[model samples]
Target: MFLFKRPLISALFRRKIQYPKSLNIKPLITFQINKMSTTVTIPEKQSVIYYDKTGGPEVLQFSTDFPVPSDLASNEILVKNRYSGINYIETYFRNGIYPASFPYIPGREASGEIVAIGSDVKNFKIGDKIAYLGNQNFAQFTKLDSNKVSIINVGANATDDQLKLYAASLLQGLTAITLINEAYNVKEGDYILVTAAAGGVGLILVQLLSKIKKAHVIAVASTNEKLNKAKVNGAEFLLNSSELSYDQIADKILEITNGKGADGIFDSIGKDSFEMDMKSIKRKGTIVSFGNASGAVSPLSITRLSPKNVKIARPQLFGYVTEPEEFQFYTESLFDLIKNGDLKIDIYKVYALKDYKTATIEMEGRKTSGKILLEIPN
Candidate 1:
């Protein structure tokens, strides 16, 4: 296995800030008040797409009529979201692929600007550009905790709203870093297999492992186009996942390794690919089952984890970000990498917030390459 950097030093972890907040960057709600709803026009209220009974895209509805705060609470920042990033997770929320509390709004990653700051909030002021990750991201104006946002500087060419919304590209990077760093403690010389290797988090994970963890990334994808995406992300090898049986795919990995299997496998396509992952992993290998794109896996058995001493565990981004130390330890590196060009995020499609059905259709059809954004009209 290939590795980079030696005697890995302790990395400083940073806490997560915010996302949908990264979309619309409003000017300071107040010049000197330090807090309060920036006192804006249009009633300081906005629109959001929501669903009561979840099933399919048709179940979604655009709501020009939505609720806004009667008062800004302490430590809260009212963000005027311009564009929100639509993710597969949101689709799962909407389509009931993953069950949620009824009548919940979807959309997770968004970038915006501060419009209102609670009186007790000091870390941020109104009008600052920020990116936030949380529920209720489909809303035009989102009130997020002051501490859950990250300040961003827009380029000269991009408007404040554009820049802030673009910041949502970092969501997968943040998630990927957290997944690799904590969920597995992935180390140098680790030969990791990334399934759905061309998808948002999959590509980001390949990049992080290649650039940060210095691991050998063997990317597995269903299409050549996706394989190319993995290639750009620093994949050491690419395996086409089409027209091949699970056993044949495992055989290919062994061929690539001269009979030795991968050290770690990140399986996202749930049941359709879980058994293959088990066959391809090396002895004492680790399997990080993250998503169930194909369908969730079945009951676990001791035989699945025994004999080879293989370690299998499922970890999600929310699991890591809830902790301050782990959150910072991972996310800070993501931004730094983006600023320095060590990572890349595709802004493949932008949709109007009301057009969520269209976005979800394209996303579920696998007709996209990177994070899709929903622009909430200002």
Candidate 2:
């Protein structure tokens, strides 16, 4: 029995929430074979999306029968992925929105049926359908720790088919976990504004803040589709991201609070909504700036925060997960919320695994609402 000690919770959560860790030649999951092929004439290849050169979606190409290692480890679960989800961070890494080493796999989330399990594995069994958060999901198959993937966290008992919608957004839940636990110490009836409310993180954050944190949520999005999604999830007020300037948005936010600004603003769009987040909040409000979809945020000084007796902080999963105590606290808390139906995952699109190029383009162009998935071929 591989008891999940509290110390290794981050490794387990990677199987559920975030992508694979830094590849420091570490294969927590490895494969083994009894009689290995010596000739090596035909490579054990896994079809993957890669770019020989970085430019755009056109640069991404797929190759079949890519060399897949046969060495096996006991606790790792090998999944013949049925579906994988896409996210913006993957896009940032792909479009060079953030720098990365070239010739890398592009996607972050996927769900697949477990095809094989190592000898030491427990909890998950062979042939169970599962989804996980990780890198190299662009490949046809990958290994994951059994402790990390959950069986019914999202699909069957999930409310109204919308539960399945958020399976790929395990990463979104991850970031939301950190923000809820670390930054604000949010309380019931606290008002919050989730910018990019229709986006990967904002959509999930809306529900978590409302249902779990017991806070009132205001959603800020760029489109009708997004607004509806956010509202359906739990947002009490929806503001058009495209129509509102900082002052205009601020006015609407204050109006929603009856002239009181929100207690918290979850702004992932960075500069586009930075000042608005500051202006749209009550005294001592906490503004959490995590991503840079619009652009990166520069430093903020104590002087700027002193006027309202407020605070500004950047929230990331890595910051919380680095500490085992915090890691266990967050992962357990988020899953508990999901189990109780407080936080819902919304996946707007499901593409065939072969449709990698199409999915990436849609995600990059912001064409989809919640999470996008790649259904792997069995």
Candidate 3:
């Protein structure tokens, strides 16, 4: 009886079994695995800001019944966002200067906790706090690839407010670090000019250049109050653009540099400052244009850079940290700076989620100085 049963089982296992072609298999497999995995009850709907067309800030519409995303792909994790950072790039998308799909959500980074994760995800579990860089973060829940998520490992005893500060600082902090390291390497004693020096990225750049890289920073801003703020952040020289014309600012930069222009110029005010950048940068200097606040820089003849033998770079933060290892290295470096008191994060304001439109308007108007954030209600 035992021999007969053994042969019968072996034959059955050896037989080829074919699944029906009409049956979708991937979700079925995921469902079977999820039944055995850890998960929390997630809401089916969430509050979100979305737009079907690109225009001014008025195009954004808030909805409390927007569907929550549940169909996470194999390397994705679902995050219940607590805070989202507002950036100038979002305004570019809203104004149609940057192409985006309709029904688009307009946020780039957020901090949250993992509520659900796909079967193949590793090193992360449900309920782990994280801050991630991804799109569609204006919603309460965001689906992100595991690679884009960074665990909030500030400390075991860190408070919720401290975590929120980390979230607000991540995107802009990473941008500043990469710009100084990769966009143009800032050497010790390098005369660097940072435009828009009171903005989110500007303040970080000023700190990294003066404090970390040991370079002399010449900060440029639109107002004296803003310049004072930049000075407190470690800028050695301050140029008030509102009080000085572009050429005058260039002249002052040269005058401060002992008749030689700045060795590097980091310009965030796009078209309106390009001429000033060209004039302020010294021979063999590099110009790093990383934003479009005043407007996109117009086309120029390549030969224009020939006279000074200058190097110009247009770098985006995402381009510099595409690999997971690159992201981790820069993120860890940024957090280390924050932890050691080498970098200070200033939150301009934390607006309620409903006030996203007002936040956008204020940031676009250049009325805010530091990082702007939106609080996502649980």
Candidate 4:
């Protein structure tokens, strides 16, 4: 009887026992099979905006059936972009102020999900959310090198608002952080002037210098409405450029600093504001000329900087964060600032992917202040 009872128990264990449906238990083998079966369907063709020749915003040609990029290099991952950010740099590329190959697709940064990856990619996997800095992002899909991408570090159930914030912040936020830290090494108590202070990078720069670096920030914008936005982000002083000539702005900055001049001048207006920067910067100050919004600065004699012993920099965002580690460091710092409420993302408008031309027009025409974003349709 004991042997028969033992055999019965062994047979019960050997037979596949069906758990009650209420138990909601999945077999290990079944789970493994389902996992292996999971695959992302990558579309062969995708909507894109591209231009064969550089010109105005009118040059951008959008199509619904542009071929999606394929054949990822070993260190690259393919991303299905959810949102893309617009910057003055794209205008540079589009208008031929910055060099690019013909038939160029203009975009510098985007946020997306990894739909596929090359064999060598281990740091990211299918379905990973990421914000990446790369070119040709005005499309449904972007194939990017692993080094340029930062995985979005939000909750498992992150909302669209959270994702959009990261998308809007990545490029301009990193630029602002790197500008203060590397371009000029801003210090607490230093008097810093940020031109275009309510624009995308400008507002962030104001906040970083004032709120994070504890610097006295003088915000310069074309209108009082824009200056007010800058003040809300922590600028201690506001100067309306529309109301003040460059000379007057320079005089005001000097007055604010008690005739000492600003220790650092962050200028994005390029040609139009270069002289103002020279006049407003203190001796041994650093002038970071980062954008060409008012058109690129013309050549100046290096001797122009010698009188004040002022240092000048024409730093680009990519130049400051070339290494993967450097990129990760600044990216993490930016994210932390947002998470802690130290940095606020101000998105002026989010345009449909097809409406990219209008977005670019508004951005370049200074019709908008704050980050401009494009929503990529599925």
Candidate 5:
């Protein structure tokens, strides 16, 4: 499978972009560039971590001579990445479980400043601070389709810490946002269960579901420390997944919910938690399987779902934001929550780009609590 997603606006920008009535996306706010703050210089080559044949983190090689793409499609924008967010899904690609093109660049999300913009780009300009989630990342500099970019206003006076936090938090933060708000439509007074609840996405889900939606959040993690972190983030109840079998986990969930089970169960740890997730949800409750941290869940027979009248949904971020307008709406809303202090970005660790292997090792072992990040040197 091709690991890289094509630029979002690469195809649409060739034609006239239009917004559907349902989206209600405001017109693109074009920022005019007057005197350029600094004439950002580009290097002919940039360092990147790449793997020719995927296997383990050891396969990744850091090369300073990696050639930067000189060609730019009309809708593409070049960003000088300050920080790159790491996700476990990238490890799947690196381990060859997910097919990828040879010499793959394994990063998916980042925050940076726009050093260059294509001629057809309208909504952004040079020096604009932006964060993006897409393919062909894991490098000091990356080119993103204009539509895929999220503008982060880290004005001239912004500090390096502010930029790093926003950039590193984008993927996990936005995933939690869309998952709670759209994937399962969490509402007030619902009982929600989150597997791997102390994880990057899990912590955010706990905060959003409990604090924002007024839902009862039951968090499951492998360690007491993680579970405690979940509690600090507003999880009302906690269970250590490592301490209980799937059936026992289900039983505990039922006890917490007064034998009714959870109204919504979000399972990111797929294989081990699949059975627990099914038994822990109430009739007609929604079960959203978003990740496969433990291992991929096998396909279930329809009869298994019919017995409980439960609804199952597997949501991927790419599928949710295929429409430019919907993507814009979600991105804006997520950032707005951050701006209003309704959400906090909890970053677990930051490593230099050259320390890619150690970073992946920590993430794969589940040693980190929140998002893992790569700090790209300017």
Candidate 6:
């Protein structure tokens, strides 16, 4: 539960918006999971994008008669969503590449307001603005464990729209944060290469690695426009992944690093980028294959690492944020950076929740940049 008590509620609910004057941020107040009764307004059934079988986006069927939970677990909170983020990973679930149960609601992350809370819920109350990344969040209202949600403090300075952007965008930002800070700690002056640098997580990685960690970031994208967008986000160098072959890109990276090669490579574009990732890093450097945007990287012999002491890691978002401490650290750190203006959220397109199929099409086609959002109708 770990919900904040009344004394800390003022901090979470600011009356006036003012930016913190300095980066000397205070630690978040700690609270235990406690239970309390709360009254809420709700409906018995709601519309949702559901699927009875795994397939493509075509399999998704919108229905209005889906039964809403009649009871909340003591540790649960109910959210009426305003927006949900669309990630490529959902396509994996929709396609049966990732195992899922039938009649599934296919969404992983959303931003909304708490409309109800179970008796044991203590920190969050009805009408509190919040956001969560979890399963079955594609519906109009989704129930979540109190521990698995974040309070979107609409400080006097941040508007509801701004907080909604934070909610829709945090998942990718957190992924990038985990990639750089935890999976492979990027150091000052480190030459790091990021694939799909104009894409959601890649764009965030470019900004954070270059601006926050002081790393030299090289961006790989599909077009000149995306490359320029990455440049604006602090990418020092660029390579059009579509224009050049992987081998050529690897060679260019080596040339950029003055033959020493990149100190580290954060690759989300797997498959075609796999061998290049191995070839592009310096001796003893690490290559993290965090996603399969270009499809899964086929199995490689462990002996490949023996050549130049190259290391490859495949880290997942769920694995990194499994611990409560780590989860809070990453999510809060991301929000702090946003509030401090160290990171920016670029939402390239917004679609109605009913247009999810089109959103997935654009996302999968790599036709959009930054983040794509689905505005859940009230």
Reference-based lDDT, residue 147, model 5: 51
Candidate 3 per-residue lDDT, tens place, 254-350, comes to: 9999988999999989999999899989999999999999989999899999999999999998887665445555666676677678889989899
lDDT of each: 0.70, 0.66, 0.80, 0.79, 0.77, 0.77
Error of 3 at 272 (Å): 0.5
What shift in Å separates residue 330 of candidate 5 from its native position after superposition?
1.7
Tens digits of per-residue lDDT for model 1, 8-32: 1234222232321432323221222
Q: Estimate the overall C-alpha local distance difference test score of candidate 5.
A: 0.77
Name every residue pair that clashes in candidate 3: none
- Candidate 3 accuracy as lDDT: 0.80
What TM-score does structure 1 among the candidates reach? 0.84
- The C-alpha stretches of model 6 lying farther than 4 A from their native spots are 1-40, 149-158
Q: Against the hidden true structure, what lDDT does model 6 obtain?
A: 0.77
Query: In model 3, which regions exceed 4 Å deviation?
Result: 1-38, 147-158
Candidate 4 differs from the real structure by a C-alpha RMSD in angstroms, to one decimal, of: 14.6
lDDT (C-alpha) at residue 345 in model 6: 89
**3 or 6, greater by lDDT:** 3
Give the CA lDDT, 0 to 100, for residue 175 in model 6.
92
After aligning candidate 3 to the native by TM-score, how far in Å is the CA of 313 from where it should be?
Answer: 0.4
In model 4, where is the ten-residue run with the lowest total lDDT? 28-37
lDDT of 5 by residue, 53-159 (tens): 97877898998998876666667678888888888888778876689998788888877788877776676667777666767768878876665534443544446
Over 4 Å off, model 1: 1-37, 42-45, 147-166
Clashes of each: 30, 22, 0, 0, 0, 4
lDDT of 4 by residue, 98-202 (tens): 788977887888877778776666556677676677788889999876644344424335557766887899989989987887788887799999999999999
What C-alpha lDDT does candidate 2 achieve relative to the native structure?
A: 0.66
Error of 2 at 258 (Å): 4.7
